[model samples]
Target chain A: MQFKYDLEGGNFSRAGHASSEVKKILKQLNVDARIIKRIVVALYEGEVNVVAHAHKGVVMVDIDEKRIYIRIEDEGPGIPDINLAMQEGFSTASASVREMGFGAGMGLPNIKKNTDQLNIESEVGKGTVLEMTTMISS
Target chain B: MKISEIVDVLNARVVCGSDKLNTEVRYAFASDLMSDVLTLDTENLMLVTGLANLQVIRTAEMADIFCVVFVRDKKATPEMKKIAEENNIVILESPYSMFRAVSVLHDCGLQPVY
Candidate 1:
């Protein structure tokens, strides 16, 4: 099955809406609880990254019998240094974003830790795309 | 510990999901950073944070945390409380600081989410 959700930038109120919806779907599908938690955490962090940095973004999910694949594509200032961005405690978020208790530089690293596979592609002037996958088996 | 016990210990007020005050939580994590809370490995944990925004509830929802205690008299907005109610996650407002809340809960036998 495939699912898609749109993300609005700078909308803190709706930051985790997509993640919550996807979690409900996973629960309805009876996906393993552990896998569902992994997916939700990664997706939630990805969603917040988009809201904090991008103008807009899209979250796409492809679920099969064994795994779930997620791709988050956002339009905004892309990462200039993926390596630095991956480091914990490194963030370029605005002060307002930091006030919300995010931008502690833990989003991407947490996503990486929770997902079985992660790939990031970006252009400094254009945008970013984050792809992640986690196994759904018990 | 039972959520009710936590409420009593921290002198917290239930902002929503009052019916769930009896929910059992094995662990507690106190943080102002949602990112730190995201890295927690276990479920059935309660989050004690000073963050009063909707994302706090959202983070708790994503991590499968059963309850949230907003320390230092921080309060969640009505909208946040509504979301918590919908998700069956309890929201509690505490008068104690984050540090004191954790210590009290710890002394009362709730393990830390390490």
Candidate 2:
């Protein structure tokens, strides 16, 4: 199964809708709690990153029996240095984002920690595409 | 600590999931940073934050947090409340500041998850 959500840039109010829905769907499907938690965390972090930094984006979630995949594509000022951005304390978020309890520079790191696989592709001025997957254990 | 006691200590208004008042919270984490809460391996935890948004409830749901308390009179929107309800998360609104709320809960035996 697959689900998609359009993430509105700078719209903190609607940021986690996709992730929440994913959680519900996983629960209804009786996925393991630990696996569901990992998917929710990874997807939510990606969602927030798109909202905070991108112009706008789409989150596409694909679920299979063995693994769950999430692809977040955003049209934004893409990361200049992917390595630096992956660091735990590196963030370019404005003060407003920090005030809302985000932009702590842990977004990328948290997403990486929660998922079994992660790939990020970006250009300085074009956009970013984040592909993450978590395997389900039998 | 029972979620109902935490509500009483903070003098908070229950916004949703009142049926979960009897839920036992073993540890508490107070942070406005949702990512920090995500990194912590806490189960049956209580989240105290001034941040009011749908994501807070979403974070709580993912982390298996038992309850969320909004400090400093932070009011949640109707949509946020609805999401909390859907997640079966206990929501409370308190006039107490974050520091005070944490202190009250700490004094009453709620320790941080570290």
Candidate 3:
């Protein structure tokens, strides 16, 4: 199965809408609870990252027999340095984003920790694309 | 611990999911950072946070944490409460600071998830 959801850049209110929907679908499909948690965490962080940094983004989800795949593509000021951005405590979040308890520089690291396979593609001043995959079966 | 017990111990108000006060939670993780909360892997975990926002409920929903205790009397907005109710996650607003709430829960034998 496949699904897509759009997200506005600065809309914190709607940040996790897509993640919540995907979680419901996974549960209805009887995905393992542990695996579902992993998928949702990664996806939620991805969704938050887009809301925090990008102008706008789209989330795509694909579920197969063995694994679940997700892609988040956003139009925004892309990460200039992927290595530095992956560090645990680095952030360029605005004060408003920080007030909501995000932009702690932990989102990508959390995403990497929860997902089995991850890839990030970005171009400075242009956009970013994040792809993640997690095994659905134990 | 039962969710009701947490409500009593922290002198918290149930912002939503009143019917789930009897829900049992064995572990608790406290943090304001949603990223840290997202990295958690466990069963029956309750998140203790200072920020009462939409993402807090969203984080709990994504992490499969059915209970969240908002420390320092932070209020959850109506929208947050509504979404939390739909997700079957209890929202507790406590007057205690994060440190005090965690200590109280710890003294009551709530196991830490570290």
Top TM-score model: 1
List runs of model 2 lying over 4 Å from the truth.
none
Candidate 3: CAPRI quality band? high
Residue-by-residue lDDT tens digits, candidate 1, B10-98: 99898888888778889888888888899888878988898889999999889988799999999889889888888889999999988
List native contact recovery per candidate, as a fraction of 1. Answer: 0.88, 0.64, 0.86
lDDT tens digits by residue: candidate 2, B1-114? 888898888899999988888888878898889879988766668899998877788788778786889999999899878878877888999999899988889899988898
**C-alpha local distance difference test of each model:** 0.91, 0.88, 0.91
lDDT at A30 for candidate 1?
97
TM-score of chain B of each: 0.96, 0.96, 0.97
Q: DockQ score for model 1, please?
A: 0.89
Off by over 4 Å in 3: none
Candidate 2 docks with a DockQ of: 0.70
Candidate 3 residues A3-109, lDDT tens each? 99998999999999999999999999899888888898889999998999999999999998899999999999999999999999899999899888898898888
| Better-scoring candidate (TM-score), 1 or 2 | 1
TM-score of each: 0.96, 0.95, 0.95
Clashing pairs for model 1 are none
Better of 1 and 2 by lDDT: 1
